[model samples]
Target: MRIIEPVEITPALAVMEAFLVQPSAEPLVVQVGQAFQVASLLTNVPEADHPVWLSTKSYAVGDVVMLEHRNYEALVANTNKNPAGVGADPPNWLDLGPTNRWRMFDDKIGTQTTNPESIELTIAPGRAVDSLAFFGLDAASIYVRVVDPYQGIVYESSVSPVSTDGINDWYDYFFTPVEVNEDFVLLGVPAGSYGSIEINIAKPGGTARVGALILGKAAVLGEALYGTSVGITDYSRKDRDDFGNVVIVERGYSKRAEFDVIVQTSQVSQVQRLLSKYRAKPLVWIGEASYQSTILYGYYKEFNLVISGPTASDCSISVEGLI
Candidate 1:
């Protein structure tokens, strides 16, 4: 078993590719017998093009601006009004939520960053990174490339998320819903200074969405015992209507797990330090490398350790995931 200590990709550490779609600065066309022209609308603007909310600038209706990591659109033409400040009783701005370029990095797994067909980014960690994990993915495949300054492209690999498991019989193959992996990890990134990692996601004819990306060095905790357990915490609601019929309200769910591990006595301090350092932070906990069900991206609820012998100790942990 191993835990990946995540590296936060701040604005200084990486640069995301520009979102493919952007609103035109000018009207797209002039309509006949109409007083207003068809103006191009902005979807997600690039960092360079994103306009910051300025108290000295006057805004017109349908204008968008950024303030405090969130985007807001002007509901009515106004001047010197702060979008984030509480001035008017009902403010003249409508909250548009986080920008598409930063949705994936916001630590909210349910809010995904999406783009048509594909999404790409380049990042420099300034340190060695051995593992990269993705969660809440809605893409066909992932490609990773590492480049070293002296040797050029040092390593590259790609993997598909589509899973063809549980298709034993002919009928099952045809009737079963197509299942794909929602989370995946890429390992063995070459270690080098002045190097960068380039990631690309491809989903032809559909939106390529990613909720969160974790890049870090993995630390071995212990050997995950065979009796580890995994399940989900569902939030769906089911109620009986007046007509005695069942009514279901669908909602999201989060994965959960409980596991035991055996670790060397000498490494107890190291393991405890790692756990303490990331107690409140989310991380990739890999229980068994070959089994996809055993890997969870979340925080540990609780953990206890007991010294069993002179050389080894027994540890138990429970983890709860972010939706």
Candidate 2:
């Protein structure tokens, strides 16, 4: 899986700039939106940034736009119809957002620890997020905390945690493109407070494995962001009224986005191993503007492959998003 790095912000004032420039024992300090600016700057970004969705005009391929809290792209290209209706057609539009719940996780930290029975991820986001989610965490009495450079520990989990096998009753089933069918839980932080977020997980037992992590405004993607991007066959419902009249309610979608992943037969195992790392956790799809917004959560819905006589050939796998 490709790692998405955070952006760098252009400090608004000289004092903040000096604080950032000078390495110190003190925690880094900055206001909100600055970290977002930095993250946006240090990347091979798009030449033409699309406008946030609008309804008054027409759109073409590669033209970015957002609607109803989701971003989208014109896949097949059409004019009058809205993006909400557009998502119903798999061949027409695509949704994009922070689908990868673990995008904020720094994989460089190494996902597990045994010597200390814990792992601390040093994150300097320069902003505050409402909640974060964890997937496939195998630990007993897991303790979590978020420390700010200036304020000490701002967020921490007091409730004793159950092992991964015992969490079916507590955690929600979050999806990740590479990883499929795993247990995950979302943690909420204090309200109206901001900080440079650093997550610390401590387990008393010998070994602890951190599967994946996601940080953002919404604790749950399926709730905060949910819509169909492709393979939506039907989205209509009907009910009978008191007088026997028909009533129809249009909800969201029967979402199932499918895509073929082609790889050589020799690399099949490698791809599978990488996919297994995610193990059914939500992934961020930053492929395009629209795809990033709507397909906030996805999984290895299904896959198929036919090896042709030991030589390098195409092995097809399909990705499915929130059902």
Candidate 3:
């Protein structure tokens, strides 16, 4: 297993342009065929368009407002009640998490940041980073490039993940349904002096959507052995009415996996420390890089490690993805 500890990207870290959209009271929607580039997204890097909370203005129930980097909805019609937990008699606002513009970095794979045609952005992480992991992608192609101020473009690669690539027979090609890869990783990214990472996303006809973008240094935990189990946790509701009719409410689902790996006893302490640090935090858990089912972006539910010999140990972990 390999884990990627992500680095949070703030407005100051973005060297080319701020990674925020212009804050407006009204909703801003990117039209079809519109280009979302870095030059157009440099203004007001910290705020969203949910209309900032005003102390003097009266708000009704269900009214949403943006405070700090998160969004909150009014639970009761009131004024002068701060969403930041100030002047709150009974907590009139409910936290809604990060705004739409910053949803890609929110670490939730269910929420997506979408754009028409393509979405491009550039950022400088300051420190050296060796890996990038993408989850919940809805695009045709992905282009990644790293640039250094003095060394220029150091590394560049493009990937197109589709199910059609494995179709070898004519019957399967004509009958099988086509699906795009939702999770991908670009490993072994060379670190440069003050490197700026650029990511370009493109879709064939619909909008380009990305759930999360993780940039960090990858640490190898252990070698994932065979017989790893993979499954999914579905959130859909199913019920039967009194009349014996079936009722179903479709909802999102998450991937899960059970990994059996062999780790060196010498590195057991380091592995335990790393897992304990990210116990509550979500990180990219890669079992086998070549298999899509082994790549999970979520938290571990349970793990157990036992010493089998002096030099080697066996470890078992169960991970559950975010819904």
By lDDT, the best candidate is 3
The Cα error of candidate 1 at residue 200, in Å, is 1.0
Ranking by lDDT: 3, 1, 2
How accurate locally is residue 178 in candidate 3, as Cα lDDT from 0 to 100? Answer: 82
Tell me, by TM-score, which candidate is best: 3
Residue lDDT tens for model 1, 1-323: 98888877644433333222124323222223322211111123244325999999999999999887678999989988888888686679988877777777777678788888888776666567889888888899899898664467899998898766788899988998987677777777876544667788889998999888888898889999988899999999999999999999998888899988999998888888889988999989988766677778899999988888899999999998888
Clashes of 2: 32
* Model 2 regions more than 4 Å off: 1-116, 147-153, 163-182, 191-194, 219-323
lDDT string, candidate 3, 121-231, tens digits = 776765678898888888889888987654578899998866565688999898788898788887899964245787887886888888888888889999999988999
Which pairs, if any, clash in model 3?
none
Model 2, residue 140: distance off in Å is 1.7
Per-residue alpha-carbon lDDT of candidate 2 for residues 1-323, written as tens digits (9 for 90 to 100): 12121222222211122123223323434553332211211111121224655566677886657554345678756676576673463556776532122222332112322224555544444455555544445454444466543456777774434423323443343432222222233435653233445455555655545544555543111111133234543556889999999999875443345433335677666656655665565443222222322232345555545465464544433444432
Model 3 lDDT, residue 98, Cα: 80
